[model samples]
Target chain A: MEKLLDIKNLHAKVGDKEILKGLNLSVNPGEVHVIMGPNGAGKSTLANVIFSHPEYQKTKGSIVFKGQDITNKKTNEIAKLGIFMSFQQPEEIAGISVFNFIKTAKNKLSGAPVDFFELKDEIAENMNALSMQENMQNRDLNVGFSGGEKKKNEILQMLELKPTLAILDETDSGLDVDAIKTVSNGINMFLNSDRALIIITHSTKILEKLDNYFVHVLVDGKIVHTGDKSLADEIDKHGYSTFKGK
Target chain B: MAKTQLEELNRNIYDFKNPDDYSFKAKGGLSREIVEDISRRKNEPKWMLDIRLKALETYNKLSLPTWGPDLSELNMDEISTYVQPKTEMKDKWEDVPSEIKNTFDKLGIPEAEKQYLAGVGAQYDSEVVYHSIKADLLKKGVIYTDMESAVREYPDLVREYFTKCVPLFEHKFIALHYAVWSGGSFVYVPSGVELDQPLQSYFRLNSPESGQFEHTLIIVDKGAKLHFIEGCSAPKYNKVNLHAGCVELFVKEGAYLRYSTIENWSKNMLNLNTKKAIIEKNGKVDWVSGSFGSKISMLYPMSILKGENAKTEYTGISFAGANQNLDTGFKVVHAAKNTSSVVNSRSISKNGGIATYRALVKILPEATNSKCSVSCDGLMLDSLSKSDTIPVNDVQTSDAEFSHEAKVGKISEKAIFYLMSRGLSEDDAKAMIVRGFASPVSKELPLEYAVEMNRLINLELEGAIG
Candidate 1:
C-alpha cells in the first residue's frame, strides 16, 4: 500500500536558526509510529513543518501527504488535507466557547452544515470520555484549563476531526499518570484500519498500554534506528545518550 | 490553501447622501445672532431664550479642552450649527415629506418601531420629522414626544429637569450644545409604570459641514422601569462636521433605567457628546454604549448615586479603524452609603487607529462601605495600531472598596496560527477573536442592534488582513 505521509530530506528553519536538517520519515495506514528523541532533537519542528507553520521556512526537500505536495501550502490548506497537529502548548482563546470552536473546525473540514444539537451531543460525549467537566463546553477555549485538561482537549479535537494522520507532540509530558492513561485511552479509541498516528515524546508512560507499534530513535534531526515496540522500552530503561552523536 | 474571497461589508447603507435641502440653515459660525435665531425658530418661551443666551456667554468664557484629542481641526467658523429640514414634526408617518420619510425608511426606523419599540422619534438634520407613541402607553400617562413639544406643552416638567443633571459649565462642548440644541426626545415614565418594549430615537445628519445638537431628557419616576435606545449616523464629506449633543436622565427612588446608544458618525466628523444620569435612593442605572464611527470621539457617560444602596453598571466598546481616534469610557460617583458600580469596557484598533479608555470613579466621604470594580481590555490587530488605558480612582474615605484592572495587547500570532491550523482562514480567525473579545458588550445589547454591531466589526476588518 502507498504511504500515508512521505518526507524526503526535509530541511527547515525558523528565523536565522536551522532546526530540522536532513530529516526523513514515512507513515503508513493502521500504524502507530513513536519518534523518541531528547530535547533539541527537532521532534517538535518535524510536527510543525508538516502543518506549514508560517514562521518555519522549508529551506529544501519536500513533504507529500496522500500523493499531494504540501511543501508550500498554507496552514489551513494543510489542515484541510486531513493533517492535524496537537500543539505542545495549546492556545487560550478568550470568549470563544469550546463547543463553537470544535463545531467551526468540523464544518470547515467537512464543508457540511452540522446540526446544532448533534454537534453539542458529540462534544459532550467526547468530554465525558476524557473526564472533562461538562461545563467546559460553555467556557472560553482552554482559558483557565489545567495542563491535563488542555492535553485532553487536544485529544478531543483529534477524535472529532478524525484526520488521516494525527501528530501528538509531547502530549504526555506535563500530565499526571491518570491523565496519561486517559489520553492513552483516547488514542486507543481513535485507532482504526485507515488511520495513522505519530506519537512524538521522550517518556514511555503513554506507550505502555498500546500494542503493535513501531518505535524510531531520532537524534540530530535524523532517525537512526527503527524497531518494533522493544526499542521504546530500551530507551526508557536507558536514555537518548546512547543514540546521540550517531 | 487558496485564500477565500469575502464580499466587502456594505457601508453604503450609511454613506448615502441626499441633496442638501433645508427650510433654514444657520450661517457657518457661532454668535448671539445664531443662538437667538435658533431660539426664535423654535418660538421658545422667554425663559428658554434666556437660558440659551446665558449658555452662549458661558461657551465664550470656556477655553478648548487640552487633555483629549486635538481640536485645532474644528473651526466653528466652518460649521453650520443648525439645519432645519423642510418639514414639521408630524404625528402620522404619512404626513412626513417623502424625502425625509425615505431617509428614515433606509435607516429602518419605522420598521424597528413597529417590531420592537413602543415609541419612535426620527430626527433629520436639526429637527424631528416624525414622532409617535402607542396609544396604550399614552393612556398610561406616559409622555413621549419631541423636545420642542415638551418644552411648549409641558413647560413646568421640562424646566424642572432640563440641564440640571449635566450643567452647561461642565465642559466647552456641552455649553455649545445647550446654546444651539434643537431636536431631541423627551420621555417621562409615570410612577409605578413598567413598559415591556423600548423607546428608540434615530438621528441622521445629511447636510455637509453641519452639526446635530439634540437634547435627550428622560425621567423614570418612582418604581418605574424604562429602556431608551439612541442611534446616530452621518454621511462622509470632505469638510469636517461636529456633533456635541447632550443627554440627561433621572431615575427616581426604586426606579430603573437602561440607556443604550450606538454612535456611527462619518470619519470626517468630530463627536463630543455628553450623557449623565442621577440615581436616587435604591434605584439602578445601566449604560450600554458602542462607539464605532467618527474621526475623533470624546464621550464618557457618567452616573451619580445619590441615595443609599443605589447601583450602576456600564458595559461599553469602541472600534477605531484607520485614521480614527476613539477616546471613550465611563464615570461613576458614589455619594451615599452602600452604593456600588461595575464597569467593563473593551476596545479594538487596527491600521494605525488609536483607542484610549479613560475612566474615573469617585467616592465621597459620606459614602462608607461603597464598592466599585472596573476592568478594561484593548486589542490591537497590528503593530501600527495603538491602545491605552487611563483610569482615575478618587476615594475621599478609605472605607470604600475600589478595584481597577487594565490590559493592552496585540492579537497573538500564536493564537492566529493555532486557529488557522484548525482549518480557518486567517481573516476568519482574527474576526472570530475580536467578536469573542466584544461578546460581553454585544450580549447586553438588543438582538437586532447586536447583529448590526457585528456587521460593523466585519466591515472594519475587511481590509485589515493583507
Candidate 2:
C-alpha cells in the first residue's frame, strides 16, 4: 500500500509548552485511522502539527507527506497539497458565506476557476444529503450556527473539497445521533480507494459504521499501542486508564 | 513555499491629471478679497456675498482643532480657494467638454448614470461641470440641480436650509468651507414623492494646490423618500490639497433619506468634511459611508432627532493604509421623545496607518424613552498600525436606554490558521478577514458601490502582510 502520510518522531510545541513528543504514525491510502487518547494526550496537537498551524512549533523530528518532507512548510502550502483538517471548534468568520468559502477553497486547491452553476449544484446536492437548508450557504460561515450545524458544515466542506487526507478532530463531539448519522454518511461518500482519513475522536459510536480501520492508542504525547478495529472497542470499554502512565 | 510578491498597493488609480486648464482660478490663499472674487465671478446675490464675507471672518477667527489629527502641516495660504473648470455646466453629456467628459468616462460615472442613477452630476476641479435629472423624476416634481442654480432659482428654499444643519461656526474647516464653497448639488424631493431610483454625484479634483469645497444640500419633504449617492476622488499631487465640503440634509415629517458616500481622495489631501441631518417627526435618515484614501481625515456625520419618534441609522467603515490618519465616526442627538439611533462603525489600519473612531451620543432631558446603540470594531493588520475608539455618551433622561460597545484587536492567529488550512494563502486569509470585518458596512451599500468598496479594500490590503 502506498503511504499517504508518515510522521517520524514528531516533537511540537505551542508557545513554550511542548505537546507532541516523539510521536510517530503512518497513514496509507484507502484506510481509516482512529486515534483515541485521553485528554492532553496530544491527539489534536498531532492534527494541527500535520497541517503546519503557525501556533504549533515543530521543534524536532520531521513530517513527510507522500514521501516529501513538509516540516517547515506553511499551513497553506500543506493544505494545497490536499490535506484538510476539521477543527474541533471552527472560527466564526463574519461576512463570508459558506458557499463563497468552499468555492474559494476548491479553486485554490485545484488551481482553476470554478463554474458557479456547477459548483452551486454540487454544494446543493451535498447540503441536501447533510440535511442542511439551502439558505445556510448564504449565511456567514459558522456564525450563529448551532454546534451540531457547525459540525455538519465541516463535514460538508470535507465532502465538497474532496481532499486526499482529511483529519477530523473531534468532528463527532457536539453532534446529535441524527447529525452523526448524516455526517457518517457524508464521510462514507468521501471514502474511496485513493483517499485516507484520520478521525480523532473519543467514542467508537462513529467508528462502528465503518470497516477495516487501524486504531492507535495515544497517551501523554506518544502513541502507546496500535491494533485492528477491535482496539477502538477495547478503549471505549476500558477507557484510557488501562493505557495511562505507559 | 513561494513567497507572494508584495506589490505596492499605493498606486492611485485616480491619479490621472489634466494640464492646469481652467476658465478661472482664484489666487492662492484665504482672504476676504479671494472670497469676494469667487462670489463675484459666480455672479452671486448680495446676501450670498455677505454670507461669504461673514464666513471669511469666521474662518480667520477660528483656529485649527486642538484635538484629533494634527493640521499643522496644512498651510491655508498655499491653497487656492477655488478653481473653475473650463466647461460650463451642461445638462447634456454631448455638450460637455470632451476632455472633462473623458475624465468622468474613466471614472465610469456616465455608465453608472445610465445603468443605476435617476440623475447624475459631475464636478471637476471646484465647479460642477455637468448636471442632469431624468425626465420621469422631473415630471414627478423632483428638483435636482447644482447648488449655484438652486440659489439663483429657489432662493427662498436655499436660504432656509443652507448651513442650517451644519453651520459655518461648527468647526474651523467648515468655516473655511463656507468662505469659498463653489459648486455642489441641491436636491429637493417634494411631499409624498418617492423616487424609484437613486441620484448620484461624482466629484473629481484635478488641480494641484487647490481645494474642492462643494456644498450638498438635500431636503426630503414630508412623506417623501430619496437615496443620494456621492463619490469623490482626486489625483495624487506633490503639493497639499484640501477638501472641506459640507452636507446638510433635512428629512421632514414621515419622510426617509438614505445618503451614501465613498470618498477616495489622494494621499496628499486633507479631507475635513462635515455632514449632518435634521430629522423631523417620524422621519428617518440612513448614512452609509466608506472612507479609503486621504493623508488625514476628520469626518463625523451627525444626526439630530428633533421630532418625536424620529429614527436614524449610521453604518460606516474607514481604511487607513500607510501614512494615513483617519479620525471618522458618527454622532447623534436625541432631543425629542421616543427617538432612536443606531450606529455601526468599523475601521481597518495597516502598514503604519492610524485609525480612530470618535463618536458621541446625547439624549437630552426631553428625549424620554429614547434608545441609542453604538458599536465600533477596529482591526489592526500589523503591530505598527494603531486603532482607537473614543465614545462619549451623555444621557440626561432616566427613561432613556443607551449602549456603547467597542472592540480593537489584530487578526487572530487561529483564524488565520483556519483560513490557511482551507487552502488560502496567508495574504489571502488576512484580506478575507479584513473584508469580512468591513462587510457590515459594505453590505449596506448598493451592489455597485459595495463591489467598488471591496475592490478598494483588496487594493489596500496588497502588500499589507509580509
Candidate 3:
C-alpha cells in the first residue's frame, strides 16, 4: 500500500512537556486506521502534529503529507491541501450561520466561487445524510448545537470538504450510542478508494461502521504495538491497563 | 474652553506635542470666534456659520457630561482643535496633493474603495481630501457627498434634521463638534430606494496632538434602506489625537439603516464620540460597532424609537489591551407604543486594561407593549484585567417588558483542555474561544468584515500574557 501520510520518529511537545515522542505511523489511501491509546498516550498530539496545530512544537521529527514535508504548515494551509481534522470540541461561532461557515471553508478548499444552488444542494444532502434538520443549517455555526449535533456538524463539514486524508480526533467522544452510529455512518460514507482516515480513540464504539485496515496502540507517547482490527477489540476488552505501568 | 473633564478613566487625548513638522492647526479650547474661524476656513455660508456660532454658545452654556464614560482628562485647552490635511476637497485622487493622497494610500482607502465599497469619502485629518461615488448610485436619486457640499446644494433638507435628532447642546463634546466640525459624510436616501451596496467613509488622522471633528448625518426616507460603514484609524503616535465626531441618523417610517464602524485608533486617542438615531413608525435601525484601540474612550450610540413598531438592534464589542481604558456601550429609548430595542455588548480586557459596558434602556409611559432586552458579557484574559457591567433600566410604562443580564468570566480551562485534547494547539484553542465569545459581533458583519474581525481577535490573542 502506498503511504498517504507518513510520520517518521515524530516528537512534539506542548508548552515545555513532550507528548509525542518518537511516534511513527503511516496511513495509506482507502485505509481506515484506528489508533487506540491510554490517557496521555499522545494519541491526539499525533493528529495535531499531522494537521499542524500551532501549539505543538515539532522538535525532533518530520511529517510528510503526499510526499511533501509539511511538518510545520498552518492548520488552514494543511486543510487546504486535502487534510481535515474534525475538532473534538468544535467551536461555536455565533452570528455566523452554518450555511455561511461551511460555505467559507468549502470556498477556501476549492479556491473558487460557490454556486448558490449547488452549495445549498450539497449542504442539504450532507445535513440530511447526517440526519441534521434543515433549521440547523441556518443557525449560527454550532451556536446552539448540542454535543451530538456539533459532532454531526463536523462530519457534515468533513463530507463537504471531501479531503483526501481525514483525521477525526475523537469525533464520537461525547456522543450517545445512537449518535455515534450516525456519525460513524457519516464517516463510513466518506471511505472511498481515494480517501483515507485516521480516527483517534480509545473506545471502539465509533468502529461499528468503519472497516479497519490497521490498528496501532500508543503507550507512553510511542506506538509500542501494531496489529490487526482485533487489537482495538482487545484493548477495549482488557482496557488500557494492558499497556499501562510499562 | 467648553470641554468637560472626565478624569475617572486616567485618560487624555494628548502626550507628544511635536512628532513631525506640520502646520494648519488651531489653538485648543472652544469659543464663538473659534467656531467662526472654523467656518471661515471652510468658507461656509453665512447661515451655516450662524449655526456653528450658535452651537458654540450652547456648548459654553452647557455643563460637562455627567453620565457614561469619564472625560475629566480630555483637556480642551491643550488640544489643537483642527488640523487640515488638504486645502480643499477633491473628487479625483490624483488631483489631491501627493502628501494627503499618500496618507490615504497608507490607510488602504483606495484599495478598499475598489474592492468592497460602492463609494468612499476619506478625511485625512480635519478636512476631507477625497469624495466620490459610483455614478449609478447618484443616478438612482441617492445623494452621497460631503457635508460641505450638502450645505451648498441641499441646505433646507440638511437643516431640517441637522440637529433635530441630536442637538449640539446635548453634551460638551457634541457642542464642540458642531462648532469645529470640518469634513464628514452627508447621505440622503430617497423613499423606496435601496442601495444595493454599502457606502463607506474612512477617517485617518495623521497630525500629532490634533483633533478630528467630523459630522456624519444620514437620513433614510420612508420605505428606504441603506448600509453605511465607517472605518477610522490613526497610527501609533506619542501625542494626543482627539476624535469627537458626531453621527445623527434619521430612519423614517418603514425604512431601515445599518451603520457599521470599526475604530482602530491608536492608544493616544481620547475618543469622545457620540452617535444617535431616531426611528419612526415601522422603521428599523441597526448599529454594528467594534472598538479595538483607544487610550480612553466614551462612546454610546443611542437609538430612540419614537413611533409604533419602530425597532433598534445594537451589536457591539470592544477590546482593550495594555495601558488602555475603553468605555463603550449603547442606549435605547422606547418612546412610542410597540417600540422595541435589543442591545448585546461584549468586551475583552487583558494586560491590566479596563473594559466597561455601560448602557441605558428606557421605556417611556407611552411605550406600551414594548420590549427591551440587554445582554452584556465580558471576558477577562487574565487576573490583572478588569471587566464591569453597569446597566440602567428606567421603565415608566406598566405594559413594557425589559430584561438585563450580564456575565463576566475568565477563559474556561475546561474548554481549553477539551480543545487541546482534540488536537488543536493550546493557542488555537484560546483563539477559537475568544473568537467565539466575540462571534455575535463578528457574525453581524458581512463576509469580508467578519473575516477581518476574526483576524483582529487572533492578533489581540497573540501577546495575551497571564
Greater-TM-score candidate between 2 and 3: 2
Query: Where is model 3 more than 4 Å wrong at Cα?
Result: A1-141, A151-246, B1-23, B45-70, B111-118, B134-141, B414-429
DockQ of each: 0.58, 0.59, 0.10
TM-score of 3: 0.74
Model 2 lDDT at residue B104:
92
Write one digit per residue (lDDT tens) for candidate 1, span B321-416. Answer: 999999999999999999999999999999999999999999999999999999999999999999999999899999999999999999999999
Interface RMSD of 1: 3.0
Per-residue error for B417 in candidate 2, Å, reads: 0.7
RMSD for each of the candidates: 2.6, 2.7, 8.0
Fnat by candidate, in order? 0.77, 0.79, 0.07
User: DockQ for model 3?
Assistant: 0.10
List runs of model 2 lying over 4 Å from the truth: A242-246, B1-12
lDDT score, candidate 2, position B387: 98
Off by over 4 Å in 1: B1-8, B92-95
lDDT of 2 by residue, A1-246 (tens): 658998999999989998998999999889999999989889999999998877789999988888789999989999888889989999999999999899888878888777888989999999999999989999999999999999999999999888999999999997888988988888899999999999999988777679789999888889999999988878878898888887
Clashing pairs in 1: none
